[model samples]
Target: MSDTHAPTTRLNKRMAELGLCSRREADEWIARGWVRVDGRVAGIGVQVAPGARIDIDPAARGHQQEQVTILLHKPVGYVSGQAEDGYQPAAALVQARSHWRGDASRQRFSPGQLRGLAPAGRLDIDSTGLLVLTQDGRVARRLIGEDSTVEKEYLVRVAWGEATVGVQPLVPPAALAKLRHGLSLDGRPLKPARVDWQNPEQLRFVLTEGRKRQIRRMCELVGLKVMGLKRVRIGAVTLGQLPLGQWRYLGPDERF
Candidate 1:
């Protein structure tokens, strides 16, 4: 029996895998007659062999360049996505008036910029600090895709608690060590995390994965209750001095 297989893939998936653009972006380009395969404009749902050459029109490239990423200093009480339980999404805070005046990026705020913008990663409603929102699908995939490894840093304030039997008031060194490498949640072992003390009452956590309420749940296992949690950084970007409830453009030179 032969082990060989066809060397072709969907054009949109190929483009996304190549980091050129996302599948949706590729579809948009295809609809606009802006994508070419082997020097001919490709149609939607087109598939190409591995050796096929793909090119994007300059117009599509320019339009992609105009897509924006935003860094928001999300305040507690806003959901990361659509409104839930009567709380508005963090995206609601991204109006012209909410744009940070100190933003170094010269792109002026416009209502059009908000169209199709969505959160790349989630920040819990009870948590506060840096939350990323973007109109670029490539950015979204890079930050939250299944294979994404970007680090998200948080400062979590905790209190000693007596909730679980046999748990201590002060987290022991052994438990802290477990937090760094030996913890499981939802029946799966969590990825190794960087956990350490930022202050007596706070823990600094650097995790490459974002599970729902992960930090709070992790602390619970070690006999601590999270009193407050704030995300401060994602990848190479930091919250910096961006005021709470304000947002700013991700500058041209900035990369994840």
Candidate 2:
């Protein structure tokens, strides 16, 4: 059987404004037969009147739609979200002229009144770099949520491995330098890390995996302990010229 009755206005828009759910949510409810107009099962995308009655099941409004997104130039030691019994949350640092001091718009920072908005991805307390926080459910799902494909890039200062280990007395330093240049301690010869030697003292490490203290652990494995590690970029967004301990809004299309 098909619905022959028609409503005066769009079911989705009316339901959204009336029930405070977003348009996308209203559509989902209609498709699942969870929304009713005048006690009749509403069809998806149907028009309904503003004065007409609209109903929605409470469960359909997932909190994801209302989430807020924030990007922070986190300094070391701050936790990404909720404070532990002792630590402070990273969101506390979202301030004006502090994080985005040099940004073009020169907007002012104010407290976000929305509750439940939180960090989407985590940078360890010991590490300082770019951190993203969100109130949007989709952003959370895209970042820390399972199946995230975003890439995080970091800058690291490491010991020069070429001079440390390789051929010994029997072999000349030239041969040892050549042999050591490509070798790494990661079980299989490490995949060619996108490395750019900044100087004799530093090397850049760009990686895709987000393991626990991954960069530090990887550096330890290669015999060069990390002197410093700072995340400079994530996906296409860079922590360029942004000051530390501050945050700003992530514009649309700024995906990692």
Candidate 3:
């Protein structure tokens, strides 16, 4: 944010416009001395206006800007964001063959969007379901960009070889089966998840961010092993029976 009353703007406002962080968060960081401007520690009262060179810490910058923003019903074995050891990028699944239209004007897929397209977030190669690819900067910035707080939902199927001679875990075996739950993979203690059962062997997952093998890891913590994983939603958008390995542009009314 830039300074005010001194021909500059408040620091928090500047940070928000640059997509560095939310103004509220910037204020907190400034108070905590975590932000600097031009090598000088920034205070909450500091002012900066547009075009001033700002240096936010690298971790604070976060990966940003989805180029295409297409959502795919990813099939297992297609990696979400990267082309990893013998794994193809889930992004590769997007082709002209998959475009569907409710509004013809928006149906025009630009080659520029295609050539510049890539996944803003990830879905591991072994996991499947709703994966988003994007070219829209706002969606990318909001969903995969560093300051993103979008929620993702999934359905997980799990199996266990044995129970510890105890009744069952409080985490719930029934709830773990085809149920909804939350996850965190940054090694921070996870946010509370809403877990429930859809059947006996499946658990639904809703996460705010993607961490490496988060659902699988969470299942392990509960003594269950993941047999299958599928993301069903992201934000308010749903996969809605879209076939695996197929993709479609998000609808205008969709709220992801």
Candidate 4:
């Protein structure tokens, strides 16, 4: 007899949890007979139990390969997502005119590529540097998923005590240690971060979590005020020499 008490979840949800695709994409693949579970073609909304084998058709894989991921050197004043308070979204800069001439990818600019392209993570309007926009759900999920462990690196210029531009005050070592692992925000403890002095004026930070205004808030808690913030790297990818307000496709050999 079958174990009727076994827990089951929607096939699309299972696919999403497995990093296969977004739930919507999973539903589309199922409708197109591109998904198989336990050696049978899956249907939309099909329920799956633990350890159930799942497979994807080659056609589905081909479609996924066509989806694109774009890396942008975002400039300050542009919001990472939708337009708000008169500031344009960063996606507006993905135009052909703004495509980096040095982009090594063979892919050319196309209007269709913008249809579903969206920022995978937020880069505050006041902050600048690397911002990722992608049409591939897999890329989005991998970078910003709730359980994601990808490291985001930033160069932060901070002021201690009074606000004096270009003046670097001596920070207590205990405070620096707190910035690395002992801070909490919104009443929740923060994950340990890699924080160190890049220069007398700038601090280099590497964090696996992205909380809203997290770095800035952490600095404030440690008696430091952030003057400027710029994200430089995410996972294995760096902003590199991508010019400000320009974008480039993620190369075929690139991951993360």
Largest TM-score belongs to which candidate? 4
* Colliding residue pairs in candidate 1: none
Each prediction's whole-model lDDT (CA): 0.89, 0.63, 0.67, 0.90
Could you tell me every candidate's TM-score relative to the true structure? Answer: 0.93, 0.59, 0.67, 0.94
The candidate with the higher TM-score, 1 or 2, is 1
Can you write out model 1's per-residue Cα lDDT over 167-220, one digit (the tens) per residue? 333678987888898889999999999998886778899999999899999988
* Deviating ranges (above 4 Å) for candidate 3: 1-47, 50-68, 100-106, 162-187
lDDT at 102, model 1 = 93
Looking at model 2, residue 32 earns an lDDT score of: 84
Ranking by lDDT: 4, 1, 3, 2
Candidate 4 wrongly placed segments (more than 4 Å): 1-4, 163-169
In each prediction, how many residue pairs overlap at the backbone (N, C-alpha, C within less than 3 A)?
0, 12, 29, 0
The reply for model 1, stretches above 4 Å from the true place, is 1-5, 162-169
Point out the worst 10-residue segment of candidate 3 by lDDT: 59-68
Model 3 lDDT at residue 187: 58
What is residue 33's positional error in candidate 1, in angstroms?
A: 1.1
